[model samples]
Target: MTDTHTPRGLAETYFLCWRRRDFTDLAPHLADEVAFDGPLASVRGREDCLEGLVGLARATTHLEVERRLVDENDVMTWFSLGVGGSEPTPVVNWCHVEDGRIRAIRVAFDPRGILAAG
Candidate 1:
């Protein structure tokens, strides 16, 4: 696992954790007061975000990161999330990192694809 102390490294590690379904590795990357503004729901706190991520992992079959952009403490990742055997759903996440952990995450995507697949 890459160092989560830096923005780019943290972003990479976060995606890697998701791809591997390693929520234990994922948890430490989040700050205690972390907030997540997801495509389907918005939440605050690390534990709540972790719970939400668990649901996302169950719904997603795979995730492929297509692109990444990092500038200082801000990181943006563009990826495709696969649901079952259906086509991959496109997603973008903007992350804010501070003090070696994620403070907030804002995700953009259409849930119609996953919903339709279900």
Candidate 2:
């Protein structure tokens, strides 16, 4: 197992934790004041961020990561978020790391299909 202290390692670890729906493992990788921003939701703080991710995980059927680009404390990951039975949604998650913990996350994606389904 890769040590989750590095920015790249932490980002990769997050996917593994998300896949297993293991918030316990993921929580330690996030900063206490972590912030989350995405097209569907925006939240601040570790607990709220974890809660929002857990809620999203409920709809997640699969996560296929295609690539990861790392630059110092910033890691940008591109993946397909398979939600339920519908086609996967292509997503880009950019994470900023500080002191070996994820301090902020910004996600981008087209929400039209998801909104139409609602």
Candidate 3:
């Protein structure tokens, strides 16, 4: 869906798209060139982002978004991740948006947290 909200609102929409695993909704919000940095990998371009997210969604289950904070061009979201029937691990995602699309994304989470819980 098209975003008519302020920068922060646009950021929220992006997260909502992720929650639903709706890449179509997410794709339009990304520029032709985008960048993603996460615990697992770093990717660039809208196509790569789409591919990575699809793979991520397939590998993750029971994902839940908890907290969201947006200011200026930055958006931070905290979430719980469940994979392979394991307990949820806390993850923090930080994103930067420009012209209504994501310019950069950085995700931080404890790898040991997942291993410990398992």
Write down the lDDT that model 1 would get.
0.87
Candidates sorted by lDDT, descending order? 2, 1, 3
Which residue runs of candidate 3 sit more than 4 Å off their true CA positions?
A: 1-4, 113-118
Q: What clash pairs does model 2 have? A: none
Q: What are the per-residue Cα lDDT tens digits for candidate 1 across 15-111?
A: 8877776689878889999999976799999999989887777767879999999989999999998876667989999999988899999999898
User: What would the per-residue lDDT of candidate 2 be over residues 62-108, giving only the tens digit for each residue?
Assistant: 78999999999999999998676657789999999998899999999
In candidate 1, which residue pairs get closer than 3 Å at backbone N, Cα or C atoms, i.e. clash? Answer: none
Question: Which candidate has the highest lDDT of all?
Answer: 2
How well does each candidate superpose onto the true structure, as a TM-score? 0.92, 0.94, 0.83
lDDT of 3 at 25: 69
- Over the stretch 1-118, how does candidate 3's per-residue lDDT look in tens digits? 5353556666667666666777776777777888999877999999998899877776677678888887788888898988656678898888888876788888998777555544
Give the range where candidate 3 is weakest over 10 consecutive residues by summed lDDT: 1-10
The 10 consecutive residues of candidate 2 with the worst lDDT sum are 109-118
Winner by TM-score: 2
TM-score of 2: 0.94
